[model samples]
Structures are given as structure tokens and as C-alpha cells.
Target: MRTPTCGPLDLAAWLTSDSMANTTSTASEDISELIAVDEQSQDVFVSRSFPQRTGNTLRIGYGGCTTAVMIQAVCKTVQPQYQLFSFLGSFLGPTSIDHKIHCRVARTRDTRSLASRVVYAFQILENGSERVCAQASADFHVPEPALYTYSIPLPTIDGDGPEDEHHAPSARTLLSRGIEDGHITSSSANSYFTNFHLMDQYFDWRHCLTSTSTQTLLSLAPHLPTTHDSKPLTARPQIEYIRLKCRLPTPSANWAALAFYMDGGLSFLPLHLDHKSLEDAGACSTLDFALRVVETRGMDFGAWHLRERRTMAAAGGRTLSEGWVWDGEGRVVATMSQTGILRPRGEGKGRGKL
Candidate 1:
């Protein structure tokens, strides 16, 4: 199919059109610089671009989340009865806001009981540098008659009964000022982060006992070096570096099944110079990012109180592999695995190869 070109203005027009609908679609225009919707045979196509530089850090607004939402949207558009079984993605490269992003979808198979598709996401840079930023393949299974049936006992929380008197905090409060802000002193916020996001979802996460301070949790995983860090430091470092290590919670039941469910939501952030670092070198630009959910479970949202996150996996002088997501649970929600012509940040891409 021919490459589609779209801009911010085009997105505005598309949003106003009656043919395009969905609250998520309406939110897309506000976050992205360009958006394109197309039809290819029985499948649909959606692409978007965002400014590369916003303030100091690379700005990737709700676009990453919107992309995931759009994939489910496409599935609903094509097959209304199908439920989202799972999703998985791998980050291939960095997406600059100065570049245009193209997303293409093609159906690989559609049968009575299952449907699968391949999605390609890439960016076209200003200097004619084109790279595949992210690639994803997904399978959506339709329920049918099976030989075996099993179910796990759902966890018990304080508000399980009719008069439990438990009230969930608003999404904004749960995300922005609470977990994302690292303010866990509030009882409601702590419960939402530790219990609601984990126990409710059937997954358990235990923080390191020594990490009782906010600084400890904030430094759980440090960002790796970007391409520009090749030079020697001219000034002495002012602050000391600290590290924290924690173990993945062991599943008491359905371990393997839960592993498969948890594996797909793992994502990582690559090291790259922030906007301030770039500006310090006398260059100002926008950075854009895209991520795909290769695998996930229905309880991901309910179990993990993920607030906000940013990730990248870059190496050498080129953008290699990366992934990012926001979870209110303060833990990794979705795992993203990427592969392409380029090698990944640390090792080769697709280490999990799920």
C-alpha cells in the first residue's frame, strides 16, 4: 500500500468528522502532531506523529496509550464480539517529534475461533533518517467450546461485600498527584498502590525491606547511558549514585499462566539525553515515542496501580530498542518486546522472544 501522509490540521478535521468516533480518538488529536486513518482491504490503518521536543524531556503524551487503545478499537470495528485476549510489543527505535510516524496493519489470519494481525510502526526523520521505532504482532482469541475448564479463586479485599464502603480514588488523583508524584502517605493511595493494583489483580509485588524511603523507590532502576555520553566528564560529579534490587513476586497459584500474562507487559526505557542536555549542546528538538502491548491480562489495570512511566532502549549512535508505560501500581504493567534491522540497547533485541 502507498505511504500515507497526515498533519496536525488533518487530525483536527478527522476528529470533527462523523465517520470517526470514540473518546480515545478524540483524545488522540490533543497529544499527537499528526494522525492518519486509512482503509486497506478488510483492515484499517491509523498513523500519527508528534513534536520531538517539548520542554526538557522527550514528550510522548497519551499517544502511546492511544495506540494501544486504537488497536483494540480496530479489533472492535472488525469483529464486535471478540474480547481482547492479549497484546505484546517490542520497541525498535526512538521516535522524534520532528519525524512522521506511520502505522500499518495487516490481517494474517481470521478464523471462527481466533484472529491475528501484524502491526508495523516507523518514523521518518527530517534528515531522511528512517527507522522502525516499534513492531508488534497480536492474537485475539474468540471463546469457543473447549475440553478443559478451570478458574482461580479471586482474591479477597476489604470491599468485597455490598456494604464494604470502599471508594476508589479518581483516575487523576490515582495517577498524577498520588502514585506518580510519589506521595504514598495517604492511606487510600497506599492501598490502591500496594493492594488494589496487586492483590486485586492476583499478582503480588513485595518491595525490598531496606527501601523504606522515597528516594529508594525512585532509584529502583536507573536510566542507562545514551549515545552522547561517549565523552569524558569535565566536572566532578556532585551527588552519589544509589541502587536498589528487588525480586519478582512468586506466584502461589497459576504461576506459569500468570508468568505468561505478566511477561507481555514488561517494558524498558533506553538512555538518551534529555531535552536539557540537548539544549545545553545548543540543539533544541522534540522527541516522540510509540509502544505496543504484545501481551497483557484483563486484570492488569485492576491489579497494578500504574501511575506514569517513560522508557527507551538505545545504543551506539542510533535508536535501537525501547518501551514505556504508565502504571498506577508503581510497577511494570505491560512488557514490550521489539525486533528490527537494528540491534537493541544492551543485548540483541527480543531477549524474551515470546
Candidate 2:
């Protein structure tokens, strides 16, 4: 739990420059500001030269990145006294790394201790055409003392690297990379994830999936779990540790970063469950997502957090996945759930290239 650098967000000062909108960009300034909402007007905000966090260079923007941006857009407009507690949204269209999304926030509810807002994310394309890529609702609240607190223990991951200030891949990445490096099987990598595309790792099977306390395994889920309990490839929750690449300069930036990481791992989870990668899918894209903040006292960008993901169910050309985020002290930082399309490779219809 690192402390965020001090200062109230001065989004206006950063907006004076037009170069802040460039899609192909980076900055020496705090990466926090780079990812913060670029306020355009009272209700509108655009990305401020935010570094694209795509797994592939395609027309479809990363749902998690867009979700992070949309959440921050509303966070910018809300009073500083309130903090985000819950968020829900749906992807109605597509977006990409080559575009900048404009988020418009509409206040739907307000009170002294609580507030609610709805956000619409529109991606401005190269030809100046804007499409509604996503829409979401966010709820924020003033701090309140907890009556009682309890959370499931932070399950120990196998030889999980020591926590660092920054620089670590998520659990999903380790699992995918393990498969690609020949731990699970020599299958092609998922086309939708940056992790699945990488061909290297420094760990063996024993380093990632087994221990004495609990036998939590990060293996592939069988296609028919209900009828295949006796099979070795049963559905089990996956665990991995992740951290931001650098420290953010403000509280608002931390929230956006949390959201960005939370929205990830869903698109490729279904494929992983069925021993398939995005390369074996026809449609694999997120349709909707939800996030609930459980605790935030010391949730900082530069600390390692565990993301546990598993498919709740998969059928009828769709899949529902759930994840839990736990801090080093076993605190529940937040909980997330997502629903998306997951068609077989030959179906050749819907969104996502795999």
C-alpha cells in the first residue's frame, strides 16, 4: 500500500495543449495525468494522450482500457470528497488503439454522502466519425466506518514472484505464457491477449499451480463440466499477481488504473477454460462489465494485487466470468464480473478476431 503523490487534480492545466490527444504517444510527466480524464466541457471528457493498452493492433479497442477511461471520466466530474464504490457498463459497439474516446457523463442521482452517474463512451475514428462504443453507470460515496470486515484469504500462488513496486505480469499472463511455453500443451496462443502472444517464461509447472495447503489449480476448464466431474480437466479458479508499471500521481489515477486492470482477463478466459485460445474462437469480446469497490484505504498503483478469475458458465454463444481482487493483506479491493460472446472459430461472425 503506497501513498499517492499529493495534489488536487488540475485537469484544466493539462488540457491547454492540443497535442494531448495524439493516439501514438507517451510522456515524461506523471503517467497518472497521462491516463486521467481529459475534460472537454462540463459534461464531456476525452483521453489525454493516454497510452494505448491494447493486446493487438486492431480496430476493436481493449474493453478494459475503455472501461478504465469511462470510469475516470466520471470520477473527474464528481466531487473529490466522494470515491467510487460500484460501476456497471455494456459495450454497444467497437473501438481501437488508433482512436480517442470521448466520454460524456450525465448525473442521475446526488446526495450529501452518495452520488450516481451514467457515462457514454464514443470513439472518434480517423475519418472524424464517432461511434458509441460503450455506456456505463458509476456510484461514488463519502467515507464511512465499517461495522465489520472480513474477506477470503489471499490464496498463495505457486512461486509467485515477490511483490515489487512495479513490473509484473498478471496471473492470466502467466497461465497463457505457461501454455505457450509448453507447460500445459503446445497449442497456438490466443490472438486476443498480449500475454498469450509472448513465447517466454522463467518458471516451471511446479512453480505455478501446486502447494500443500489448498490444491487450487490454474488448468484449462473442460467444455462439459457438469457431466465431466471425473475428468482431470475440471473447472478451477485461476490466480495471478499483477501491479502497475509505475506509480500514479493522484487518487483519481489509481481508480482508473484499478478499473483498467479489472476489465481485462475476461475476453480470453472462456477460451482458456475450454482448452482453446482466441485463435480457436470466432467471436470473443466483452459485452458488459461491473465493478464494486470493497476497500480503498491503502489501494495504490505501485503495489501487487491478486486477480482470481473463473468462468461462471458458458453456453448459448455467450459466457459469464467473475473475478476477485485482493490486496497483499488479503483485503478485498474490489470484485468484478463480465459477460461476453464466445463463438467457435468457424462461426465467423460477431466481434473479436479469434
Model 1 spans > 4 angstroms off: 1-44, 48-77, 127-130, 145-217, 220-354
Which numbered prediction scores highest in TM-score against the true structure? 2
How well is each residue in 1-354 modelled by candidate 2, as lDDT tens digits?
111121222223222335435546422244455456678888888986543535444434456667778877898778988889999988876554455677888898889999999888876544455567788889999988878889988765545354321223444454456565554443323432343221112111121232210111133322313322343322555555666657776667777778777776676775555545566777677888888888758467577677777778777888889888887787889889988887776554634332
Clashes of 1: 37
Once fitted onto the true fold, the runs of candidate 2 whose alpha carbons sit more than 4 angstroms away are 1-34, 50-53, 126-129, 156-207, 210-234, 348-354
**For every model shown, what is its TM-score relative to the native structure?**
0.38, 0.74
Among the numbered candidates, top lDDT falls to 2
Q: For every model in order, what is the number of clashing pairs? A: 37, 4
Q: After superposition, how far is residue 341 of candidate 1 from its true place, in Å?
A: 16
